[model samples]
Target chain A: AQTVTQSQPEMSVQEAETVTLSCTYDTSESDYYLFWYKQPPSRQMILVIRQEAYKQQNATENRFSVNFQKAAKSFSLKISDSQLGDAAMYFCAYRSGGSEKLVFGKGTKLTVNP
Target chain B: NAGVTQTPKFRVLKTGQSMTLLCAQDMNHEYMYWYRQDPGMGLRLIHYSVGEGTTAKGEVPDGYNVSRLKKQNFLLGLESAAPSQTSVYFCASRTSGGPSSYEQYFGPGTRLTVT
Candidate 1:
């Protein structure tokens, strides 16, 4: 079975600063997909960014980016110039490159201070 | 599009009680999923449907059942609710092709409490 882990239970950062959330997964598959999802107070799960294990280049979406180390099974999300709106519960997810099911890690609660 | 929406945003049930959670999507997505979120745990897939009339079990499918009768609707049912089953439920829809299949649009979850 594949599992994802988020070591940080909670994290806080000042507004306009940068913060990185840690994530690691256990998978034997050579190819898979990784994703970062944010759940705001509204309880809506929004996709932040995603990375493919076969790709060597990291994925970036505006202020949100990911540092994916395929060999280490690490997929970390880095939020740049964080704002109050960035406060949310962030989750790291894994999926087989050819499968539709996604497995997620225990989430990290992020707080952005003004 | 209204995106993905779950009916009965808040529901309370007694032990052994039965209920069904309805999920509807405006997008003509081929994949729909039902997931549960608990404290300290990220969303866990309960059941999913690849297309109309086809359902598959996810990581946790012990106490739940699901159906996808139409292309845009997926239903989750609890035959006997338990306290441990109390959690926020989310419905998501995704396209089932190429690179875009990884992106899932989630609904504002439904909070269910089983006492």
Candidate 2:
């Protein structure tokens, strides 16, 4: 079974500053996918970024990026130039290749202070 | 487009009561999933369907039933609600056929309180 872990339960960053959320996973499969999802108070789960295990290149989406260390089984999300809207609960998720189910971490509640 | 929509944004139920939560997607996705989000448990998949008239158990499927009779709709049912079942429910869908088909679009979750 695949499991995702987010060690930080809460994180805060000053506006315009950069923040990194840590995530680790346990999976035996060599081919899989990693994802970062954001959930605001609006209750919608939005995709932040995605990374495929075979690719060594990290995934970047606008201000969000991921540092995926396949050997360490670590996939961390970095938010650069953070804004107030970045304040939300961020979840790290994993899905094995060709599987429909996603395994998610507990979540990291991020606060962007102005 | 309303990518994915869940019915009854909020609901309060007593123990032993039964109800069905409906999820509809406008994107015509072939895969649909139901997940429950607890305070610290993140989102655990309860049930999922790969296509119409098909359903499968997920990580935590106990006490939950699901149906996908229609191509655009997925229904999750709780036979007997429990306090432990009180949590936010989210529905998601994604394209099934393609190389880059891992992205899932989520719905505005439905909060349920079982007292």
Please, what are the lDDT tens digits per residue for candidate 1 over residues B18-83? Answer: 999999999899999999999878989999999999999998999999999899999999999999
What tens-digit string does per-residue lDDT give for candidate 1 at A15-44? 999999999999999889899999999999
For all the candidates, what are their Cα RMSDs to the real structure? Answer: 1.0, 1.0
Local accuracy by lDDT, each model = 0.94, 0.94
> Which stretches in model 2 have alpha-carbon errors above 4 Å?
none
Model 1: docking quality category: high
Residue range with the least summed lDDT across 10 consecutive positions in model 1 chain A: A97-106
Q: Among these predicted structures, which one has the highest DockQ?
A: 1
Q: Per-residue lDDT tens digits of candidate 2, residues B28-86?
A: 89999999999877899999999999999998999999999999999999999999999
The TM-score of predicted model 2 comes to: 0.98
Task: Supply the TM-score of chain A against the true chain A for every candidate structure.
Answer: 0.98, 0.98
